[model samples]
Target: MIESTFPILEVADMQRALAFYRDALGGVVVYSYPPDGEGEPVYVSLSTGATSMGIGLTESPLPPGNVMLWFYVDDVDRVTTHLTGHGANVIEGPVDQPWGERTALITDPFGTRLHLAAAISAPPDEE
Candidate 1:
């Protein structure tokens, strides 16, 4: 079961992405994969008013064509199984990630990337 959905943008640079989204666009960083450390984050979740998006660092920008949809689900395995049974292409995972999600990468019949994830950790309490 899916709880919510958001868009994720792939970027070549994490710092630049943060500057654009957080500084320029006035978005709030709701969550980041590394939480806090010396290095740059690999992924960040930002809330721009009512809408939110995910910024993910990639080795390089992918050739533009399609958008990715991030689905927050109740069960990663069950959702993955249902999608694959209907012919979705499984690229990786239903694996536990360092950021506390069990996730899977799949492309639907029309080649739209779907990121399915289930949280493995409780979210930090809101301020």
Candidate 2:
């Protein structure tokens, strides 16, 4: 049985990636393994409430715009604005969906796609 799953993203620059995840997404770096000398971190684990994500340094070409990281936020518009201010490209809008959710799509500086959504209020039942 799978208890939980952690997604690991390979990045070329760890520092830049950290800024995006920590600052933009409001994630905390729970653990990190920096290089032996004065250099960027090779691996880092970020925790956002119950979810955890891993970031690793890679020299090979990274698969940009591949995986999508979906986040359920209290306010989709607010979070999308915050991310855009922090250099995240807005791929789509904060539009209301037929399924009763407001969603927004964005891509971080490291080319990681982020999908932010918030549940819409249910309409009152007609008497």
Candidate 3:
């Protein structure tokens, strides 16, 4: 039975990752191994709305994984701009997709690909 699923990234530095995900992306802290104010954290879970992901400390770098973190924001363009200013590299600016979503692609400071998307407009029923 499928219970729950979430992606966990092994990072060289937990603090730097938290800075990007929690500070820059505005993800709320869901859980931390050391629970803020204790020893350095080896693991952390963060959430942006219903979606959550984990970041764990790694002694050495791991080969890039076949994964892309997807996020739904209220304003793709605005979020893209904000992330770039926070050290994210923009692979593509926000563009409307044929499927009706405005999407942008960027990589975090640690080279984690983030797919930022938003609805181009309200659904037909709402309009």
Of candidates 3 and 1, the better by lDDT: 3
Candidate 3 — what's its lDDT? Answer: 0.89
Would you list the C-alpha lDDT of every candidate in the order shown?
Answer: 0.75, 0.86, 0.89
Ranking the candidates on TM-score from highest down gives 3, 2, 1
TM-score of each: 0.49, 0.85, 0.91
> Stretches of candidate 1 above 4 Å error?
68-127
lDDT of 1 by residue, 34-76 (tens): 8778567999999966679888888866664578767676788
Poorest lDDT segment (10 consecutive residues) of candidate 2: 32-41
lDDT of 2 by residue, 14-68 (tens): 7788888887788998887873465668998999878999998998757784699
Compose the digit string of candidate 3's lDDT tens values, residues 1-127: 9999999989998888888899999999889998878999999988888888999999997766787999999999999999888889999989998778999999988888999999986645533
Q: List the residue pairs that clash in candidate 3.
A: none
Q: Each candidate: RMSD to true structure? A: 14.6, 3.5, 2.6
Candidate 3: residue 12 lDDT (0-100): 92
Candidate 1 has its poorest 10 consecutive residues by lDDT at 17-26
